[model samples]
Structures are given as C-alpha cells and as structure tokens.
Target: MAYGLSEEEAVSSISLSPCEIMGIEKDYGSIEKGKKASFFVSKGNALDMMTNQVTLISIDGVVQSTSNFQYELYLKYRKKDTTN
Candidate 1:
C-alpha cells in the first residue's frame, strides 16, 4: 500500500507473499480445496471498502461476530457518565 500498489495487487500480495516469504506455499496463503477457508467478506471492492465496513469475517470457515467491544462499552457507560 505504501508503494501505491493497486487494490488487486495488494490483495494478491496478501495471498501470495506469505507463501513466498515463509516458504509455506505448500500449506498456507491459498484457498485450496483441502485447506482451511480462512477469509473475510466485504461489501465493496477493496479500495472502495474504506467507507464500507466488513460485513462478515471468518477463520477456517468459522464465522465470527463483528461486535465492537469498545463501542459497546462506550455506549454502556456513556449514559452513566454525563461528562461528554
């Protein structure tokens, strides 16, 4: 991203660099049929997604909640503390 790589190039970097850098291309950094489906889902294209939040996230195909703990805490305490 610092080098101004396009969104596609950036995406491919994450998917391929790990394999090349760590020498683990055989097992990680890809979505093979037998490998785990550790990926996330976004509503828009990579660059455009800056304004769009991630809608779904998963690890090894296990869906994870996107709840923001800090935001929740703020909401929980904002009413209690009228200092804002």
Candidate 2:
C-alpha cells in the first residue's frame, strides 16, 4: 500500500501528495522551475505562530499584517485591568 493513515500521513487521507495537490510534482513541493512561492517560516513550530507571535508572514509573495487579533485584545484588556 503506497498510502494509509498515520501520524506520517500529514493530512493526506482525502488527497494526493503535496506535489499533486499543488499540481507541480516535477517543479514544486520542492525547489525548481516556475513555481509560485508558498509556505512559511516561524520562530518555532509554524502552527504555534497562529497562537503565539509571528515575526512575519508572507502569502503569495505579499507580506501579511503583523497586527494580531488575540494579542491586540490581550493588550486592550491588560491596559484596562492594570488601570482598574
């Protein structure tokens, strides 16, 4: 069996390999020809950046806003709590 389900599956149960998903098996899901840039780099686990802080995030070559919704709310309440 070329595929099954396990921790190594990496969320492939409903789909083909990353190369197939992106439709660039020969040029993408790796470094090669005219492949649009994708993916991200985080200070720690990439997923953690969603809850933690993200130094930077670029999607489709455009940088994302650094303003974090949760962090902003925390700051808003933290200031209120301290003042109170």
Candidate 3:
C-alpha cells in the first residue's frame, strides 16, 4: 500500500467529515479555540514532521515552555529535595 494520501485530500476528508458529524463545524476543523485545542502547529510545511518543531505546549491556559521547561522542572524538583 502507498504510504500516504495527498495533503490536500487528507485535510479535506477530516475537515468535512468528523467536524460535521460532531456538530463542531464552525470551530473544530479550524483555529477557533473555544471548540478544542486539538490541532497541530506546523512550521514551514504542515507535513514536514522532521523539521517542524513544537515551540510551545499549553493545556487549559496552563502554559508549558518546551524549550527550557524540562531543565527548569528538574531544577525545581532538585531544590525541593535539598531544602528538606
């Protein structure tokens, strides 16, 4: 089997089907937030997964800084142990 469908086709399929079925036709298939934060952020090209990087990740308005966040988290935890 072929590995993938054309990008245009793939986007069209999802944009028309599930969004309509679930009655989220106005917001879910696009960038409207009140519907859901379920979408991808692409850099340069949408399908270019290798070079496309996620700069930030947020959930329910709680921001997560992917860049130094991991290191910061480790430091926070380490400090807690040291102060005990």
Candidate 4:
C-alpha cells in the first residue's frame, strides 16, 4: 500500500499516516494497539478495482451504517450509465 505514494500525498491520501503522526496511529489504521477497530470487510481483494466490495463494516467498536458510508455507498449506487 505504501508503494506509489509520495510523502505528503501518501500521508494525506489515506487515513493512516496522519493518524500515526498525530499519535493516534496506535488507535487507527491496520490492526494493532488498544484501538476499537474498524473495517471495510471487502468481499474481494482490496487491490482489485473490479472485485472490491465492502460487504461489511465496523467502526469505533460499533457498526454505524453499512450502505451509506460514503465510499461504499458510491461504489454500491454510482454505476456508470452505459445504456447508450
């Protein structure tokens, strides 16, 4: 995941580096520490653009919303109109 990203871009591109820099990294990004834990729970490989499906989610020791978590919702509802 830390492959093609520049320093600042990498930090800003994902919710990890910044969280770490702010000393909150222990409680966020990847699996570690006393963090409550959260996950997209994709059905397929996270690197595969075509197979990415965030089927389940957990946030802040709880599950808030699955079908409307912004990114997942976009992937779920925003299909390109190829009817033409």
Candidate 5:
C-alpha cells in the first residue's frame, strides 16, 4: 500500500497476479467455479501481519486444521504452571 496500490490491488498482486503470470490462472488465483478452492480465512486485513490472524484454511475444497506444532506448543506453555 505504501507503493500506492490499493488494498485490493495489493492482494491481487500476491494472489491472482502471480498465478496469472505463472500461467496457472485457470486452476489457481481468484476464486471461481471449477477453480481450485484453496485459501485462508483471516480475522483482518491479510496484508497486515499484525491483523492477519488466520482462523481457517481450505485446500482443494477440504478444510484443514489451522493449529500447527508451534501454535500447539504455545497453547500448552501459555497455561499457568500449577506445579510451581
């Protein structure tokens, strides 16, 4: 956005534009019928790391678990140490 691109353009540059440049737009890029359904749902602007909290993800039309090993470890360690 600092480069003057709108939010939509910024997003497209990373998503749709790349696929189109790679000649895979027919199967990737912007969501459409018959196209591969793969994307992540974020709580806020995906362009902003501070606000881009991914809550869900889908790949080839299948929902995937968002929790990863690091996230799981964080969750486990975030609890107060009862044995202390």
Candidate 6:
C-alpha cells in the first residue's frame, strides 16, 4: 500500500501474485473452479495486525481447527482470577 498499489493489488501481491510466480496459480491462486479451496476467514482486515483475527481456516477444501497451544493456554489462563 505504501508503494502505491491499490488495496486489491496489495492483497494480490501476497496471495495470487506469489502463486503465479511459483507457477501454481492454476491450482492455488484465486478462487475458481478446479482450483484448490484453501483460504482463511478473519474477523477483520487480514492486513492489519491489530485487527486481524483469524477465526477459521480451510485447506484443500477441508476445514481445519484454528486452536493451537498458545490459544489453548491463553484460554486456560484467562479463565483464572489474576487479581486474587
């Protein structure tokens, strides 16, 4: 974005553009028939670190768990009364 690319182009630079360079655009970049259904769902803008919150992810047309060790630990610890 700082380089003057539009929001769409900036997003493509990280998604479609890379796949095109890797010669995997035919099966990886851009959602289309016959292409791999791999992507993530975020609650907010994916480009903004502060607002980016990935809630779901799918790979090769399969939904995946978003839970991880860190997230599990956060949930466990956050449930405790730290003020005590």
Q: Give the per-residue Cα lDDT of candidate 1 at 18.
A: 67
TM-score for candidate 3, please give it.
Answer: 0.40
Task: Give the TM-scores of the predictions, in the order they appear.
Answer: 0.63, 0.47, 0.40, 0.53, 0.88, 0.90
Can you give the lDDT of residue 2 in candidate 1? 45
Give one clash count per candidate, in the order shown: 0, 0, 0, 0, 0, 0
Stretches of candidate 2 off by over 4 Å are 1-16, 22-28, 31-33, 47-53, 81-84
Model 6 scores a C-alpha lDDT of 0.91
Better of 3 and 5 by lDDT: 5
lDDT tens per residue, model 4, 15-60: 6766777777777865666776865677876556689777778888
Off by over 4 Å in 5: 82-84
* Higher-TM-score candidate of 2 and 3: 2
Model 5 agreement with the true structure over 5-78: per-residue lDDT tens digits: 99899999989999989999999898899999999999998899889999999988899998889989999988
Better of 1 and 2 by TM-score: 1
How does each model score on lDDT?
A: 0.75, 0.55, 0.63, 0.69, 0.91, 0.91
Residue 48, model 5: Cα distance from true site in angstroms: 0.8
For model 1, residues 1-84, the per-residue Cα lDDT tens digits are 547987768877878686679887666677787777777777776446475567888787899988898979988987795665
Off by over 4 Å in 6: none
Task: For residues 1-84, write the lDDT of model 6, one tens digit per residue.
Answer: 658888899889988999999999999978899999999999999887889999989999999999999989999999898786
5-80: candidate 3 lDDT, tens digit per residue:
7777667565656888898777566556576555544456545656767765654345665658787888888767
For 1-84, candidate 2 gives per-residue lDDT tens digits of: 134446346434322376787776654354345764544555754333355455775655677777779989988887765552
Off by over 4 Å in 3: 1-4, 13-16, 31-40, 56-84
TM-score of candidate 2 relative to the true fold: 0.47
